[model samples]
Target: MIKTSFISKTVSELKPSGIRRFFDLAANMEGVISLGVGEPDFVTSWSVREAAILSLEQGHTSYTANAGLLELRREIADYMHKSFEVTYNPADEIIVTVGASQAIDIALRATVSPGEEVLIVEPSFVSYAPLVMLAGGIAKTIQTANENEFKLMPQQLEEAITPNTKAIMLCSPNNPTGTQLGKEDLIKLSQIVKKHDLLVISDEIYSELAYDESYTSMAAIEEMRERTIVINGFSKGFAMTGWRLGFVCAPADIASAMLKIHQYTMMCASTMAQYAALEALKNGGSDVEEMRSSYRRRRNYIVKSFNEIGLDCHTPGGAFYAFPSIRLTGLSSEEFAEKLLMEEKVAVVPGNVFGDSGEGHIRCSYATSMDQLQEAVKRIGRFIEKYKVE
Candidate 1:
C-alpha cells in the first residue's frame, strides 16, 4: 500500500456532518415527514434560473476570473452598499465562491494556523467546528441557551476568548436556532473583537431572512468592518441553493489571500451561476421579499403548532428552523429524535448534533409547506403523548 498514513491527524479527527446520516435514512424511507434539512422548499425564482439558461445559450460558458465575474462582484458591492450600508472595493474586497460553504472553508483555511483557536457559539450550523479543525484550528464552542433566545451573550464570548484565539465564527439569523442578533449584541461583540484585535468570520447567509428587523451585518460596524469577512450567498434568501453561488466581502488584503487559495483549489464558481447571481442581486428584491414573507408565515405556523402540541418552542424570528425543548420527554435530544423517527415517521435533527448545549432539544425546519408542517405536528404530538422516557 502506498502510505495510508499520509492523511494528517488534523484531517482524521474530523467526522462528516451528523445531519447527513439521518437525512439519508429519511430520503430512503417512504412517506417520511422531514423537517430535517434547512434548505428552501421553493425553487430559485424563474427569472434567475432564466438568466443562467440565457448565459449558456449565449455561450458565455468560459471560466471567469478566479475572484469571479467583475459585474457580479460589482453587483454584490452595490447590494451591500444599498442594503447593508457597507462598502468594499469590489476589485479586491470581494471574491465569489462555490457557495457560502466554500467561502467559509477558504476563509478559515486562510486565517487559521495550526493549533490556534476559533470560537463558535452553539447551537450553530454543523460546518464551523469541522471547518476549523480542517484548517488545523481548534474549535472552542461557547454554549448559548434557549432562555437567552439562543443568542450568544457578550459575557460568554468574552470568557471564551484566549491568547491563542484566531477568530470568532459568527452566524447570525443563525441556523438550527433561527436567532438573529440585534444592534446591541452586534455592537457589544464588535467592541470585544476590537479590544482583543481578533478576526471575525461573519456568516450572514441568512441575513435577508430576518422577520423582525432587516438583518444586520458586522461589516456595517465601522470599527469591525476592516477585521470582518462577510460570508453570504444566493441560497436561502434568493431560493438558489443548488446554484452554488456565494460571495465574500472583506478587507482587500483578506480577500486577496482567500482568492489565492481559491484559485489553486477551485478556479471559480460556475460562470452561469455567477451570471444568475448577478441578476438576482441586481433586480431580485421582490423575489427575496416574497420568499421572506412565506418563510415568516411558516415560522409562525410551526411555532404555534409546536406550542399547542407541547414542544415549548418559541417563535424563531429568523431563518426557517425551530429549536424546541424536547427536555420534557426526559429523553436526551438524540433519544427523542430517534423515537420520533421510528414511531411517527417524522424526521427532525437532534439538537445535540450542533453541540452539547443543544441537548434536551430538537431542531425542526419549517421550510416545508403548511400542509406538511401540520402533518408533522400531529404525528409528533402523538408520539410524544404515547412514548415514555426512561
Candidate 2:
C-alpha cells in the first residue's frame, strides 16, 4: 500500500480556485445561466484563424525560438508602441508565452525570492497570490474598497510596503472588480514604488476593453519603463482565449532573466498560435472594436439593472465584469452566490474568493449574451427580494 504523501506541503495546503468550483457546479447542472468564468464569448476573428490554418497547411509545425519568433516579437513591439506608447526591444525585451497566465507565472518565478514579499492589489484576479506563493514569495494583499471604486490608493500601497517587499502585481481592467486605473492613479502609485525601489508586474490583459478612457501602461510612465514588467496577450481583447498566446515586456536585464526561466520551463509558445497572434496584431483591430462595443452596451445595461434591483453596483471602467454588493440579502458572498445558484439557476463567483475585501460582493461576467444577462438579472432580482434584509 502506497501511503506516503507525495505532494509538497506548499502545494497541498493551497486552496483550489473558488471561481472554478462554481463553474464546475454550473457545468453539471441543467438549464444554468453562468456568469462565473472570465472568458470572452466572441469567436477568434476569421482572419486570425485563417492565418493559423495556413501556417498548418504550409507545414510550419516545429518549435519556435525560446523567446518566440522574431517577426512576431517585432509585430508585438510595434503594437505595444502604437497601442500603449511603450517601447520594447524585440530581440531581448520581449518573450511570447503560452498564455497571459503563464507570462504572469514566469514573471513571479523569475523575480521573487524565497521569504521575500510581493504586494497584491485585492479585489483583483485569483491567480496573483497563488502564483507568488508558488514562486516561494509571501503574498501580502492591499485590499481596495467599493467606496474607492476598488482602485488601489497610494496611501494603501505605501502602508503595505515593508523591507522584505520585492514587487507589486497590478491588474488594471482588474478581474472581478473591473476597475481600470487611469494615468493619474498609476502615477501616484509609481511615485511610491520608485521611492521604495520596488518592481512592478503590470497585467494589461484587458487593455483593449477600456470603455471610458485610453488604456495606459505602467511602463509608459516616466522613469517607470525600467522597473515595470508588462504582461499582455491575445486572450482577452482578441477573443483568442483558446489560442494560448501571451507576451511579457521588461527592461533588458529583467527580460533576459525571465527568458532563461522561460527557456528552461516553457521553451516557446505554440508556433501556430504565434502566427495567428501576428495576424491579430496586424489586422484584428476592427474585430476587437466590435466586441468592445458589444461589451460596453452590456455593461451599461447590467450595471443599471443591478442598481434598479437594489444591488448597488458601480459602473466599471473596463473588463466585462460587474461586481455588485449582495449585502442587502444579509448573506455572506458565498452564501449569496450558492443560494442564488440553487434557487435561481444562475451561477456567479463569490467575490470573497478574490480576497477579503471582496466579501460583500459577487462577480458576474457580462461577457455572455445580452439575453442571458437579462434573464440572469431577473433571476438575481427574484433571489434578492426573497432574502432582502429590509
Candidate 3:
C-alpha cells in the first residue's frame, strides 16, 4: 500500500531557517558560545512587565478588539508620528498583531494574488520569501553586495521589476547585515518604487537600534505613505521578544483588508501583551536607549575585533550583527560555520543561508554579552589561524 503525503507542496518545499540549524547544533553541545541568533541579551524592562502583571491583576484578561485595543492603536499612531514622521489614523489604519512576523504575513496574504511577484531584497530576513510563496505569490530576489555595503540600489530595484511584480519587501537596520539605508538612499529607491507603481512592505523592527545615523522610514519619503505598509514591534528595540507583540500601519483600505485576514486567523493579539506594549510606548524610551547604547558598544568591539583578526567585517550602521567575510579561509560558508562549531564550539550563522550573494561570509550577532563576545572572538581567531589560506 502506498502512503499518503500529508504536507502541502508549499510547506514541503520550504527550506528550514539556516540561523536555527547552527543554534540547535550549539544547543546540544556543551561550552558553546553562540553568536547565531538575532535576539537581545537584555531582558524586557520592568515597567513593561509590571504593566502586564497589573493588567492581569485588574482582570484585563478578556480579548481585545480585533484591531487590538483602541488605546494601544492610538499610542502606536503617536509613536510612529513622533519617531518616524509618518502619520496614520488610529481608528482604521493600524492593527496590532502577534509579532512583526505576523504583520508581514497578513500584509502579504491580503495584497498578493496567485502568481503575483514580490521583489525581495537580499540578504533579507528568511521569512519574507517563504511568506510570499505561501501566500501564492512568487518571490523574486534582488541580491545586494558587500561592495556597496549590502544596500539595495535603485538601479537594481528598477531592473528587477516586471509586469507581474506587485510589491517589494524591505528591512532596514537589516537582519544578518545590520545595514540601514539613509534618507538620500531611500529617496533614490522611492523614485524607482513610484516609477514601477509597486507596493512596499517595510520592516522597521530595529528602527530604534540605529547607531551611526538617525533611522528613516520609507513611508516618510514624499508621496510614498499611501504605498507603504510599516511593520514594527517591541522585539528588538524594547527587549520584549517574549511578549510577542507587533503592529502594522498602512492606508485605511489596505489595513482593512489585512484586518479581515487577521481577524479570522489570529482573532486578536494578547490583551496582556497589548497593555504591556502600551506601557512600553508610553514610558520605555529610557530603557530602549540603555539597550541601544549597550548594543552600540558591542557593535564597536565586535567589528574591530573581526577586522583585527583578518576577517574583514564592515562596520554595521545599525542593528547588533556584524557580517564579516570569511573568504580568507577558502571554505564555503557552510563549511566554515560547521567546522567552527565542531572544532571551537563557537556558533555563528553562515552567510549563504541569507542569499546567494551572502556566500563566503558569516553573520555574528553581537546581541550576546560582552564577555561571551570576547571569548567567541578569541575562539574564532584561533579557528581562522588554523584555516586561513596561505
Candidate 4:
C-alpha cells in the first residue's frame, strides 16, 4: 500500500478545482442545463480541422523544433503583429505551448525562484495560484471588487507589492468576471511594474472577444515589450479549445528560459495541432468574427435577463460570461448554486470559488446555445424568486 506522505506536500495540499464540483454534480443528473464550464461551445472551424487532417495524411508525425515549427511560428508572429502591433521574433522570442495554460505554467517556472511571490489579480482564473505554487513560488492573490468592474487599479498594484514580490499575473477579459483592462489602465500598471521591477504575465487569451472596445496588449505599451510576457491561444477566440494550442511571446532571455522548460516537460506542442493553428492564423479570421458576434448577442441577452430577474449582473465587457451578484437573495454563493442545481436543474459556478471577494456572486457562462442559455436563465429566475428574502 502506498503511503499518502510519499506524495509531494505541495501536490497534496492543493485544493481541487471548484468549477469541476458543480460540473461533476450536473454530469450525474438528467435535464441539467450547465453554464459552468468556460470552454467555447463552437466547434473548431472546418478549415483548421481540415489542415490537421491533411497533416496527418502527409505523415508529418515527427516533431519539429522544440520551440515549434518555424513556419507556424512565423505565421503566429505575423498574426501578433497584425492583431496587437507587437512584434516577436519567431526564432528566439516565441514558444508554442500545449495551451495558454501550459504557457502560463512554464513562464512561472522559468521566472519565479523558490520563496518568491507572484501577485495574482483575483477573482481571476483558478489555475494561476496553483501553477505559481507548483513552480515553488508563493501565491499572493490580490482581490479586486465589482465596484471597479474587477479591473486591478494602480493603487491596488502599488499596495500589494513587497520585497519578495517577483511577478504579477494579469488576465484581461478575465475568466469569471469578463471585465477587461483598458489601454490607460495598462499604462498605469506598466508604470508600477517599471517602478517595482516586477515581471508581468499578461494572459490575453480573450483578446479577440472584446465587444465595446478594442482589446489592447500590455506588451504593446511603451518599454513594456521587454518586461511583459504575453500568453495567448486559439482556445477562446478561435473556438479551438480541444486542439490544445497556445503560445507565449516574450523577450529573448525569458523566452529562452520558458523554452528550456517546454523542451523537457512538453517537448513541443502536438504537430497536427500546430498545423491546425497555422491554418487558424491564416484563414480563421472570418470564423472567429462569426462566433464573436454570436457570443456578443448571447452576452447582451443573458446580462439583460439576469438584471431583469433581480440577479444584478454587470454587463461583461468581453468573453462569454455574465457574473451576477447573488447577495440580494441572502444566500451564500455556494448555497445558491447548489440549491439552484438540485431544485432547478441548472448549473452555474459559485463565484466565491474564484476568490473571497466573489462570495456573493455567481458566474454564468453564455457560451451555450441561445436556447440553452434562455432555458438556464429562466430556471435561474424561478430559483431566485422562490428564494427571495423579504
Spell out the clash pairs found in candidate 4: none
lDDT (CA) per prediction = 0.90, 0.94, 0.94, 0.93
Model 2 vs. true fold: TM: 0.99
Judged by lDDT relative to the true structure, which candidate is superior, 1 or 2? 2
Give a tens-digit lDDT track for model 1, residues 131-224. 9988889999999998898988898988999999989999988888988998888999899999999999999999989999877899898688
lDDT of 2 by residue, 171-194 (tens): 999998999999999999999999
Assess candidate 2 and give its lDDT: 0.94
lDDT assessment of candidate 3: 0.94
Instruction: Give the lowest summed-lDDT range of ten residues in model 2.
Output: 1-10
Cα RMSD to the true fold for all candidates = 1.5, 0.8, 1.0, 0.8
Ranked by TM-score, the better of candidates 1 and 2 is 2
lDDT of 4 by residue, 268-301 (tens): 8999999999999999999999999999999999
Stretches > 4 Å off in candidate 2:
1-4
**Candidate 4 structure lDDT:** 0.93
Writing each residue's lDDT as its tens digit, candidate 3 over 1-390 gives 644487788998999988888888899999999999788999899999999999999999999999999999999999999999999999999999999999999999999999999999889888899999999999999999988999998889989999999999999989879999999999999998999899999999999999999999999999999999999999999999988999999999999999999999999999999999999999999999999999999999999999999998888989889999999999999999999999999999999998888999899999999999999999999999999999
**TM-scores, all models, native as reference:** 0.97, 0.99, 0.99, 0.99
